[model samples]
Target chain A: MSVDIKKYLEEKQQLVDGYLEANLPPIGTPPTVLHESIRYSLLAGGKRIRPILTVAAAESIGPPPKALLPVACAFEFIHTYSLIHDDLPAMDNDDFRRGKPTNHKVYGDGMAILAGDGLQTMAFEWCSRVDLVNDIEPYVQVQIIAELAHGSGNQGMVGGQVLDIQAENTKVDFAEIQNIHAHKTGKLIRAAVRAGALLSGANLTQFDQLTAYAEDIGLAFQIADDVLNVTGTREELGKDANTDAERGKQTYPSFYGLKGAKKLAQECADRAISRLSSFDEKADPLRGIAQYIVSRRN
Target chain B: MSVDIKKYLEEKQQLVDGYLEANLPPIGTPPTVLHESIRYSLLAGGKRIRPILTVAAAESIGPPPKALLPVACAFEFIHTYSLIHDDLPAMDNDDFRRGKPTNHKVYGDGMAILAGDGLQTMAFEWCSRVDLVNDIEPYVQVQIIAELAHGSGNQGMVGGQVLDIQAENTKVDFAEIQNIHAHKTGKLIRAAVRAGALLSGANLTQFDQLTAYAEDIGLAFQIADDVLNVTGTREELGKDANTDAERGKQTYPSFYGLKGAKKLAQECADRAISRLSSFDEKADPLRGIAQYIVSRRN
Candidate 1:
C-alpha cells in the first residue's frame, strides 16, 4: 500500500515540479546575490507537498490543476522563505537543510534574510497579479490574502514558532505540543488547501470537508516528522536525524515511545481519509497524499 | 523661521509619541524573547516623522489628526520593522539604532529576524482591524493595502535597498544614487502622505498636489540624512554618524559635497512648500514639516 502511495506522490511531484520551476523568479542577466539566495532554496529538492496539495484541493472543487499554478507557486515561496529563515543563525541555526548548506550558509545571512523577505512579499504580489481567467471573483483574491496573512501572522506560524522556541529544553504537555504543531505547521498547510478550494469557488460544505482532511493530514504529517527524527538514519533522511533528541527537544517518540507515535500517526491517516468520503473520485489525490504522510520514511 | 518649524514638529512629535506608546504590544506575561526584541526597537526614540506625516497629511485634507491614528500606527509598524531588519548582520550590520543596541545585537540574530517578520505582518493585521470612523470607505482600505504593497515591495523600498547594496563602494553617478534613494526611502514617505490623504477621500486635485509635495520632501529627507551622516555629531545623531563613509556606502554628501547636499535639500524644501501653495492656511503644518526636514539636526 505504501509503495503505491510513493508512486502516486512521484507523479504528483513531477507536476508540481514543472509548475514551480516555471513560476520561480527568472535568473535574469546580472542577477543579484539576493536573487540567487532566493532561487537556491526555492529550487532545492523537496517533495513539493504543499504546492501539490494546493493544486489537488483546487481540482477537487473545480478547474484544471494548471490554472492554479500561480497560487501553488506562492505557497512554495512562503514555505521556502520559512525554511530559509528557520535555518538562519538566530533561529534553528542549522548549517544544512535538505542535504545542502542552508541559504544563510551559502549566501550569507544578510542576503538570506532579505531573500526571505523578498520571497514573502513576492508571494502576495504573485497572488494579487494572478490572472484568474474571469472565474475567481475579486473577493476571492481578498480572501486569499486574508488566509495567507493569518497563516503567516503572529497568531499563526510566528506564534507557533515562539512557543516552539520557548518549548526548548522544557517538557510541554501533549495538548500544548499539539497546539504548537497545529499553528506552527498546520495553519499554512490548511491554508494551502483552503486557498485552492476558495479559488475554485468551493461551497461551504466542500470547504468544511476539505478543512477536516487538511487538519488531519497536517497533524499526521508532523507526527510522522517526529517519528522519522527518532527512527530514521541520516543516510535515509538526507539530513540530520535524531538531532531533536540530542538537543532535548520534545517529540512524540520521546514522551510516548516509537510504537505509540506510529499508532497515533496511523489513526490520523485514517481520520484524514474518512473526511474525504463525501467527495467523489476527484479527492483521490488528496487521499493518497494523506496515506503518504504517515507511511513515508523520508 | 526655523524656530516655528521646530515648535510645530515638537507638538506633532508629542502626539505621535503618545499614540505609538499606547499601541506598543504589551510586554506579554512571561514575555517571549522575540516579543521583547520587537518592543525594544519599537519604543526606541526617533522623531516619529513617518507617522506624524501620515496624520498631518490626513489633517491637511479634511479631518482632525486623531482620525488617522490607526493608519499612522500601521505606518510606524512598517517603519520600525524595516529599521530592525536594516540593522541586522546581513544588511547594514549596524551595532546601534536610535541610541540603542540594534535588535540583532540585543536579541541575537534569529530572534531579531523573527521580530522583524512579526512586525511586518502586524502592520497589515493592524490595518485589517482598524476602527474606520468618519465614514472612511472600504475601497480606501483596499487602496491602502495596494499602495503599501507597492511602496514596500520590489518596486519600492526593498528595491531601493537592493540597489544600495549593489552600489556599495562603486562609483555610481548622481542620477543612479538619486533613483535609489527615491525608491528606497522616498517611496514609503510618499506612501505615508498619500495614504493619509486617501483615507480622508481627497480629490484628484488634492491627490496631485499632495503627491508632488511628498515627492519633494521624500528626496529632501534623504538629502538631509546624507548631510547628517557627514556633518552631525554621533551623540546628537543617536546612531553612528559618518558611518556611510566608513562603510563605503553611497550618499548625497559623498557624491556632491556636504555644502552642495545642504543646498539641494533646501531647494527640495522650497519645492515641497511651493506645491502646497494652492491649499489654504490648513496646509501650514505640511510646509513646516518640509522646513524641519532640511533644518533637523538628527
Candidate 2:
C-alpha cells in the first residue's frame, strides 16, 4: 500500500524531538541562562528536516532510527545554531522564527551569541561521542567528523554566510547565487545524507547515489525558500515576508522570477527522486521529503 | 648546556607560524574578506603559547616536533578565534590586540564574528585530519576532537566567558573565580598538553603526569595574566592595560591582593615544575615555560 507522506513525516518529526529532549543537556546546568537559551531554540518548533534526513538516510540502509539519534541531534544543533546567529542584530536581525520570538529576542544579544557558540560546540561534542554508544567503526566516525567540519566550516556554510552578507545590495550573478546556496544550505544537507550512509557502512557507489539525491533536493529546497519568501505570510512563515526583495538579496526568484523558480523547484524534486530508483521501500520517505520541500508554504 | 630561553621560544614560534600559514585557507578564496580577516588575526604576532605547549608536550613524550604541527596549529586557531570573538563590541569591546586594531575594528562586527567562527570550524577540520598525516590511532584522533570540543565549547571557554560577563561589577566569590579561571584559560591549556601526550601514545601514568603539569601551569598562566593586566604597559602587553579592572571584570586580583596573587602565581609554577620530576632532560622546556609564566611581565 502507498504510504501517507504526511503521517510518515509527522512520525519522524516526533522521533527526532523525543530523541533530542532525551539527549540534550538538562535545562538547569550551571550556566542556567546559556543552557536555557540552547533549549529554548532547540526545542522550539521547526520542521526538523536536517535531523530527519539523517535518521531517514540511516534507516534506508539497515540501522534502526534510534541508532542515529546522536548524529541526528548533532545536525539539528548545528542548524539551530546557524539560525540563532543568522537572526542576530548584526545579521538578518529577525525578531521571530516560526511564530515565536527569535533566540536573541528573548535571551538578549550577549546570551544569544554564547548560546550559538555553545550549541555549535555541543554539536561537535555529540559527533565525537557517536562511537561510544553505537557500533559504527572508529574510522567511519572520524570520517563523519571530517565531513561535518568540511560542510559547516569556513569552506562551507560559514563561508557561504560571508558571501551572502557581502552580496547585499550588489548585482549578484547566477554563479554567485548558486555558490552561496550550495555552501550555505546544500553542504550540510549533503553531509547529513553522507553521514547516514557511513553509519550503515555503505560502499562508495551507494554513497554517490545518496549524495546526488541530497544535492538536487538541496537546490530545490533553496528555490522553494525563495518562493516562500515572496509568497509566505508572517503568521505562517514566522518571519517577515518580502525581506529578500526589500534587501535586494540574490535569490532564485531574483534571478529567474517566480514562475521560473517554481519550475526549477519541481525539476529538482523530480531529479532527486530519480536518484533513488535503485532503493526500495526505505527510500520512500526521502522522496516524500523532496516533495514536501517544494510543497510547504513555510 | 642551558637552552637560550629567548632563542628557543623564537624558534618554536616560527615553526608554528610557518605550519599555520601553510595549512590555513589562502586569501582570495570566494569570500576574500573573511579569509583575509582570519589570516590577519591568526598571522599577527602574539605569543604562540598554546600551540607551542602542544608541540612541546609531544616532544617531551618522544615524538618529533614537526609531526605534531597540525594538532598544534589547531590549538592556535582556536585560541586566535577566541581572541577575535572576545574583542567584539558586544563582548570585551577592545579595539587593539597585539598592537593591531581588533578584527571587528577592521572587518566590521558581522565579518569579525564570521572570521572567529571560520577559525573555530577550521580547528576541528585540522583535528579530524590528524590521522591523515600521522600514526595516531583513529580512536585517538576522535579523542582529540572530543578534547577540543570540550575545551572550547560552552561548558569550557565559551561557558566561562558567559559567567565572566555575568560576573561583571558583581562581588564574585573565590570559588566562582576559580571556576571561571579553570574553564576560561585553563581547559584549553590543559587540552594542549594532553593533545601532545596523546600524539606520543603516552601510558596512563605518563599522561597523568602531563595532565597535572598542565593544570598547575594553566592556573598560573591565568594568574600571570591578571598580574600583567595590572602591571604591564600597552607597548609590552600589546593590548590595553587596566582594562580588566576598568571593565569591572573579576580577576585573581579581585579575590587576592596584588601581593597575594603574585605569591599564588609562584606557588602554581612551583607545583607545575614538581609534576615534571618523572621526565628526564626532555621536559626542560615545559619547566622553563612554567617559570616564565610567573616571571614575565607581559
Each model's Cα RMSD: 3.6, 1.6
TM-score of each: 0.88, 0.97
Interface RMSD of each: 3.5, 1.7
Task: Report the TM-score of chain B alone for all candidates.
Answer: 0.94, 0.96
* Number of colliding residue pairs in each model: 2, 0
Candidate 2 lDDT by residue in tens digits, A115-183: 888888888898888355446666877888888888888878898899899989999789989989898
lDDT by residue for model 1 (B231-278), tens: 888788888989999988878887778888999999999999999888
- Segments in model 2 whose C-alpha atoms lie over 4 Å from true places: A64-67, A130-134, B64-67, B130-134
Chain A TM-score, candidate 1? 0.94
* lDDT, candidate 1, A1-298, per-residue tens: 2235567668777877786667665666123566777778887788888888888898887675344777777778878888888888778888777888888888877778777877777666666553553545545665666677677767677777877887899978988889889988898899899988988888999999999999999899999999999888877786788889888989888878999999999999899999988888778788888988898888
The TM-score leader among the candidates is: 2
Error of 2 at A1 (Å): 8.0
Q: Pairing residues by index, what is the TM-score of model 1?
A: 0.88
